[model samples]
Target: MDDEQQDGRAVRVERDTMGEVEVPADRYWGAQTQRSLEHFDIGRDTFVWGRPVVRGLGLLKKAAAQANHDLDLLPDEIADAVVQAADEVARGELDDHFPLVVFQTGSGTQSNMNTNEVVANRAVEILGGELGSKDPVHPNDHVNRSQSSNDTFPTAVHVAVALELAERLQPAVDGLVLALEAKAEEFADVVKVGRTHLQDATPVTLGQEVGAWSGQLREAWGDVRHAGDRVLQLAIGGTAVGTGLNAPADFGPTVARHLADETGLAFRQADNLFVQLAAHDGLVAVSSSLRTLAGGLMKLANDVRWLASGPRTGIGELRIPENEPGSSIMPGKVNPTQSEAMTMVVTRVFGNDATVGFAGTQGNFQLNVFTPVMAHGVLESIRLLADACRSFTEHCVVGLEADTVRIAEHLEDDLMLVTALAPHIGYDKAAAIAKQAHRDGSTLREAALASGDVTDEDYDRWVDPAAMTRPG
Candidate 1:
């Protein structure tokens, strides 16, 4: 290591396998991270190191160190220092030290090295050694012992995705389901005209409509949960390729056990280390489930906005929260802003699903080269869906109210109510009655009474809107 000055600031020269490079004196990242920054200054999509991926990496490194110590592969002092340093990284205390972008190596080698360097340097500091000295602990031999980026990065991704789905996205979906269920019960007696092909069909209680939306979300939540479960199998021991190589046979299972204990998740070693390293099918499944959820959320939001279309001129069957001005030019206008936001989020999730699916197909041979972007896409989808669900539930679904007067008007005027007459009067005569009412602009009762096809008492009994909402 060389101590140097650059632009009147203190700098340190760190050497990797390639050569020596200058890293900022204050940052913990070393030569490999600096090389990645200089070469792949590609995008603004840097990993937010304080989020799940970095936290997962930190937790994984700590587990790896503990496993190595338990296996007698690492000394106790080095393992203790590394564990403490890795814990700090896991808790996001060292977030600023990890400054790599997500678009680096496809295997995320640079990011894995970044973690190793930060932990090793910090551990060295803990042992009263100079930074970048490689004195007490080597980034590879000690900190990254018995692991490779090919295996470690994928394992970290699985841990991150599983934890995120369980801790954030699933809870948000549950909250939305509960909110819609409450609305369903609240509007149990509200009768409204139903539409098919954008034309009036028959009467239905608002409760039924809201309950259907809740059912869709509950199903989607289950799909996401099941998909998340598939990623709990990790690829830790698969070292460089599918082969265990330098790592012991029990290394992967040992690390996974430690991780499970730390995170309270059911993490385990993958059944096939080769498949875990080569294909991202598990993450693809998770993304597909998220896409399904996005579709459901889109339908629910569109339905809400359509039902709450207008207080004066449109459907006007439901009222939503008036959070802010809907338009800059129109006064007293309140648009379904939450619905619009949710639909936009759905579109993004759809795009992410496409990215993840395509990335999953790019596994060349021994290892997938698209792990970093795949991780980014899946994690972004989860975060966006979780946040949008919570926002929609709080700002829109919880505040929904039925416009009873408008619903009554629509229900009373709908000509499809004539369907209740079809079984009483022959279908042909019922059709004629609806056609006559539409042509003459008369009520169904007036049209039927004039036609001598039905009696007033029969019309009253057959066309009860509340009774029409249920089976006879």
Candidate 2:
């Protein structure tokens, strides 16, 4: 078995073209995978980056086997074995075998070879041979017959991102929108003082305010879907440098069709593999969409936090649901924890978007080297945003209650309510009334009455705040 005892441990000496290296007897990887493990120790991130890529690679290999078998390139038995092994990999039965980090190899060649070795070893074991044999189903000659890391890695990025947005992020965002709509309906009759530039402006129903947040989320969802459409175009058939070296002419299209069937997502070969492989524009677009969504979430969370500021002093027009005690020393203090968590997610997404943009630009000639980081950034944003949306929906939006008494108090006390008298009493009279209210430390209603600007009947008819809120 090429194994020897050294320091009471059995080590297998696996030889590649460079030389022989000692590998663990129990692992499925060969010399190259072993070398990567020793070489790239920059992060303790583990094989997390490889999960989606490996899953996509599994699907790619399965499709390639089918396509090659149909083309009479791969024999039926080996193709069947490879398909079974790849399916297991796709289902994440062998994630532990992929031990490389995200920071390894710019093209993710090590990760690709890592998948190849694992699939090949598993295929060999399925064929009644020992692991690491590279026997009936060799890693390159069989499993990776018509593929290159250049094409496969980028294709994996597309498959993982598109599937994640459709299956996870979209549903979470939809749930948030629905929750916001529910809140809007619940607070339909509650009127509050609107603010512009953090100064009192006029009057608005709480329903209108919450509905604006819902509209922002809807727009963000549309942007995510548009970006996802770009990722559905794969560079798989392009091979090493977009030249399809040693691959069949129809390999790309056939494999893409099989991938579409496997994923139930409309995956297509890129119109030009050169452009697709050379740049990560699709991922950058997705990150940009995520950044936009983050911005909307940040604004909404800040609005909620400010609206629910204090129980005694600040603008308490909305009561945020208290899930936990806010302070250790202070009594009866409840914070907008959900909003805080949501804003934190927003900040992380902003940083991730920046990282993706920078990584997208690191492409050289025919291959983007920053693929793993780009993939990690996109996936992280999707995962964090999905969780944040669901959490914010449940903890804050669903149980949020409008402080209607405080809202009415604020509306009655706001100086900007004099804006209602602008058309009827003239701007100069309205400005004088506002100045009198501020100078006399009186309410707008009290000062307007004292000014003798209009009769009580005229004031009642013209200064209807609710009527001011609607379209003229």
Candidate 3:
């Protein structure tokens, strides 16, 4: 019963120096990959390394095969097979084969070998050979030619992060900024009472307030873009310890050219692959920039939440579109759901950045043992922020409206309008007028006129809310 198991076809034996492993027969992965699966029985989360990293690794192998073929380092037939198989991986056709967790070996050697074995087996199949043959396409000797996990893993991180930022996050943030800019222009003339320390102080146009948020988002976008520049310098071709022992002198630049062509971004070899491979400061820089962007998003979301607080009892200066039922029990309640979602997403981004910062400093000597965790943190942050920006723009910012009537009503009867008179009249006189209005429950206009602090003509000219929003 145990000798020939059910169907006797589920798995086959694959051998490495450690021992033989029974790998699933249908899988594109081999011995080391099976060992990783058996050793790290961590979680069910399959996409821990994300799609971009997997795809970037595929691209790296594809480019390396071509470079090796061009330099006459590998045979043309085998190179063509490897290239075709790698392209399939890059297009996400082989995602199921990459099932390693994010909690693998610190150097990501297991993950890299997983990729190598998958690509090699698939290429072997394409060349009309049996799986795990190491025949026409060997995992390490052929598929992983002139590379090591130390260099390739970090290179894949940079490629994946940079491409995701330029393609997804940048466009989403651009949309948010444009939405806020349009709102600022639309609300330019709508004046409202301004507060400091949660108390009324002066008047300002609602456009100016919205414009401030737009400026913050633009600055955040700039920081992210600048950080991406650092991420474009890759650690590939460094091989074992940045010495490029097995790799040719031209391999790094040649692969960089291929990557630049494939991604449509200006990628280059790292100036010092030793430093890049040893330290994850490049990832930390990008994470820090994302943290700054998240901070800006938090401020903007809070402002929106406060501005659209209530229709009756709260500071209802703005109205957000009600996309869903606010509560299950409360029948007539509406909430700032989009702003709330954005704030929560920003909080997660902040946490992810902190994780990235901690992982970045975990480098010991020649290599960082924290690549998997660092990649997970930074990639998740980018993904969440991109989606959050799009959600905030579509659900909240685009459909927002100004409460012109409420704004005007608050601006007219406000005692803070006396601030205008403080310059024309003495401070003591203005204070007396304001105090009398407050005590007698009269409007500032009535108190000022009765007290004869300034003539009615001067009061009308100086206390204009629209004029107060600008310089004298």
Prediction RMSDs, each to the true structure: 1.1, 1.5, 2.2
**Residue-level error in angstroms, candidate 1, position 68:** 0.4
For candidate 1, lDDT tens digit of each residue in 336-443? 999999999999999989999999999988989999999999999999999999999999999999999999898889999999999998899999999999999999
Model 2 misplaced regions, further than 4 Å: 4-11
- TM-score per model over all chains: 0.98, 0.97, 0.96
lDDT values of the candidates?
0.92, 0.87, 0.88
Q: What is residue 300's positional error in candidate 1, in angstroms?
A: 0.7
> Which residue pairs overlap in candidate 1's backbone?
none
Over the full model, what C-alpha lDDT does candidate 3 score relative to the true structure?
0.88
Report the poorest 10 consecutive residues by lDDT, candidate 1: 42-51
Per-residue lDDT over 131-190 for candidate 2, one digit per residue giving the tens place of the 0 to 100 score:
666788899899888899898888877888888898889999999999999899988877
Worst lDDT 10-window in candidate 2? 44-53
Residue 152 CA displacement from its true place in model 3, Å: 0.2
Model 2 pairs whose backbones collide? none
What is residue 388's positional error in candidate 2, in angstroms?
0.9
